[model samples]
Target: MTSHPAAEAFGATLTPGTRPTVLAVDLMRAYFDPASPLNLPDDGCLHSAARVLEAARAHDVPVVHTRVSYGPGGLDGGVFFRKVPALAQLVGDSPMGELMPEVAPRGDEVVVVKQYASAFFGTTLATTLHARGIDTVVVVGVSTSGCIRATVVDAIQHGFVPLVVEDAVGDRAPEPHWANLHDLRTKYAEVVDEPTAITYLEGTS
Candidate 1:
């Protein structure tokens, strides 16, 4: 673990466990489709996440993916869907809910669907990882200020080291995105670059 003056001051630094798993959260087509409100103009983050996933799979690392969908009329989404009408595109079998082809989950790799921001909320993510003896969660995917932040916070609370790939998560605007990343780096998780994350995954046994 490299020493950071801020981390030293805050007394918050993380040591990633030997058993690391890739948790690619919300890598959906909605963020890539031009007509979709969720579409991000610059999708470099998606490409970065794709590379991270490739490295994790090549190194035999366990992988888990997440997608958000609500029941018809978003009854399952509760207040969140009503708050963000864009969620309508992800209802049921809408093509917008499809996993992005680049980082799509393959056979046998676990995929969890949820209605909320945090992957662990009302989901079996924590239990599932604990069952497999997974101790570190390497996170990559969209909207750094939302789902990614929520997942990392919960991962730390659930006793999993959260290693967020800084280059592999994005938001509609840079302000909230960078602000949340800085906070996560200092308080919740180790926000590292994509290459750093990939190297770590490759080095893990």
Candidate 2:
């Protein structure tokens, strides 16, 4: 991997904490179903996310899944709803809003419902993590340039080490995906592959 000069200068590779919680962000049907407007090209993210989830479960690491939802008229989504009309399909009892079965949350896991791109935005995620003594957040989900990036930025700001599993996240386009990963690696979080993240989870647990 080529190191960025800015990242090298700023010392951006922050150490991960011993305690980690897998923050699976928006791996829902909308992003997985090819027929859906928000769909990506393939189910690669589902497979990767499932592997990370399996590792987390076996290691007894905490897992939290986030789904985007809005109010009836999208009044709760605010300007964000207006900005992105496709998000309207996620509100209410829309089946597209549901999580993909492959990466479904177990009953024991916390499911965070959010309206904005950032999982921490207008949610109790920070407090929930604090209560559980989780110092590191392992983020995995769809759209690297969107929610995944937003969540990583928020996770670090809230005083937690953020590690983004590269393969476990995807975007509709490869350019934005790779670009965001590079940006996140240089700025907000550690960008690792699924195997590396699994090793970390097992070692810590």
TM-scores of the models, in the order given: 0.95, 0.95
Estimate the TM-score for candidate 1: 0.95
Model 1 alpha-carbon miss at residue 94, Å: 0.7
Clashes of 1: 0
lDDT of 2 by residue, 144-186 (tens): 9999999999999999999999989999999999999988888
* Candidate topping TM-score: 2
Q: Could you give candidate 1's per-residue lDDT for residues 39-122 as a string of tens digits?
A: 987899999999999999998999999999888899999889889989999999889989999998989799999889999999
Regions of candidate 2 where Cα sits further than 4 Å from its true position: 1-7
For model 2, where is the 10-residue window of minimal lDDT? 4-13
Clashing residue pairs for model 2: none
